[model samples]
Target: MRFMTTSDKPENATGGESAADDTAEVTGIAAQDWDRASADPQYRAAVVDLLGALAYGELAAFERLAEDAKLAPTLVDKAELAKMAAAEFHHFERLAGRLTEIGEEPTRAMEPFVDALDGFHKQTAPSDWLEGLVKAYVGDSIASDFYREVAAHLDSDTRGLVLAVLDDTGHAGFAVEKVRAAIDEDPRVGGRLALWARRLMGEALSQSQRVVADRDALSTMLVGGVADGFDLAEVGRMFSRITEAHTKRMAALGLAA
Candidate 1:
């Protein structure tokens, strides 16, 4: 599977036209320059795939968090997880709306990603509250980093929307605090949780590979030699950045990366 990275330089146009004009022609959406960029056939197809993947991801996150809330040791923690789950659902709704606005059926768009994401959750189901907390923080951070990298390739409006939905919802800080406090209470947990974190990363990557392999349009948009495209080196750098961010998040939880 090939990955694409975000270039530090500005995105170039496909032809002589600006990225905005290209998007508007392809996507048929009348939002902004970024939205206009969605009109490009490849770009529009990739955007739909992106939105669908994101919508399903958020929906699955909501369900998983809600389940995790049941394992919370305290009423307060349970409520907090529940709140986070609700927030995920809200993001899902926004992405679904965007899909509809683009003349795509939201359910159809999300359908292709369902199995891969579901398999990920099944493989990495948390056994305890602490494990759940770590997954919430570390797993979500990795996914968010990836989406942010992809957003860099998008037009301004579309980029803004992607960034907006991927924003941290305070769950990261909460998970970090809780996991750190737990480790402070029992040092042995640090080792176990660190191993668990590794397992989560592996499972997520496995599923991600499946998604990328299945979604040709999305993959082409990222790494194809089209105008404003990303090269393999850029993709390597993007993964490196994601790894660095994941390591930092693990450190924040007082766990080894």
Candidate 2:
């Protein structure tokens, strides 16, 4: 396993101070309202795909968090997980509402994603309480980062909704605290959790790529086919930023990246 030192923690992966200015100037889509942006059929299709994937993801997070709560060692932990699960469900409702508002059937929109997302959950099922916590933190954060990257290129109204739904449901600090405590009590646990996190990382990234690749409209929107969307190089940089953020998260849990 690779261990991260203090110096290895890079700057915040969300581009530096000028990222906002850069996005506004470069992606003309960033400034437009959804009504104006959705006039393009391809962009509308991409947004539908995006919202579908996110709605299902939030729904799944709710389910998984509820199931994982059963493994919590204390009532406090269980309650915290339950609260987060409720928040996840709320996010799901918002996404589904947006889909309906856009004249898309929520079930139909989310159908295309259920299989892939469910497969990810099955493959990355946590073995124990600590593993579940790591999955919640590391796995969920990676997805959030990807959505945030895509949101930067989206129109103003859609970007606001996407970012709002991706908000952390209080899982970050809770997971970090619980996982670090477990590691502190037993140093050997860190290695196993680190390995588990790496597996989650691989599966999550693969699922993300597969989701985009399977949807032509979404893939086109991502690869510069839409208004100033990400070029290939930007896609690479986005993944790098994601990886860096994962490393920092692992370090926060006192685990090697």
Candidate 3:
């Protein structure tokens, strides 16, 4: 994974940062003359395709999570998830703007990878509220780790955008708690959720492979003895972390991981 500037700090997120400055931070990425990069054409296409997919992924995630938030059992839980979902909408707008600043039409740029991401979601759509939380907790976190990896390849503004969109621990924790609560109500959910989580991972990998197939600039094949962007090792490590979290969540609900 390449290292780049990403504003993961809470202060740099939507709350403290001026909305107008978002344009400046994004413009910094545009300053880099992408046309000058002499990387493999496939590699460049790969990177763009990945970013485009993530850009649209956030958009779809926001819509789905917001709708799912209505499943919250209590008014407070409903409000909390709904607010988090709105935060995602704001993130979607910023990412879309960054894509435009980088010289790509947000919608058009996102088109190539749409099938993969959307298809992944469709195949692994959660069966129940607990499964939905598991999907949110696992899927969004993995995507964040991936985003951080890509941020390394971008300039400061792009890096900041990537970091800004990362899921906050607080929100993820809330979802985790919700999942545990549901599971505690019935231990049988343990096996079901585990399978659901695995399905999510499988679907994610399937879409990811499709993305890496044509584009080499992002995580191109072993190029010059090194993969360009994302690699299995890094993804595996991320999955290890996710697995740990999943285990902890399952234990909290009185089940084995």
Number of clashes in every candidate structure? Answer: 8, 0, 10
Q: Which ten residues in a row have the lowest lDDT in candidate 1?
A: 23-32
Cα distance off (Å), candidate 2, residue 174: 0.4
Superior by lDDT: candidate 2 or candidate 3: 2
Indicate which candidate wins on TM-score. 1
Residues 92-167 of candidate 2 have per-residue lDDT tens digits of 9999999999899999999989988999999999989999999999878988888877886687799899999988
Between prediction 2 and prediction 3, which has the larger TM-score?
Answer: 2
Q: Which pairs clash (backbone N, Cα, C closer than 3 Å) in model 2?
A: none
lDDT of 1 at 145: 91
Q: Is candidate 1 or candidate 2 better by lDDT?
A: 2
* Candidate 1: residue pairs that collide: 23-36, 23-37, 23-39, 24-36, 26-39, 26-40, 27-38, 27-39
Give the whole-model CA lDDT for all candidates, comma-separated. Answer: 0.79, 0.80, 0.61
Q: How would the candidate models be sorted by TM-score, starting from the highest? A: 1, 2, 3
TM-score of each: 0.88, 0.87, 0.71
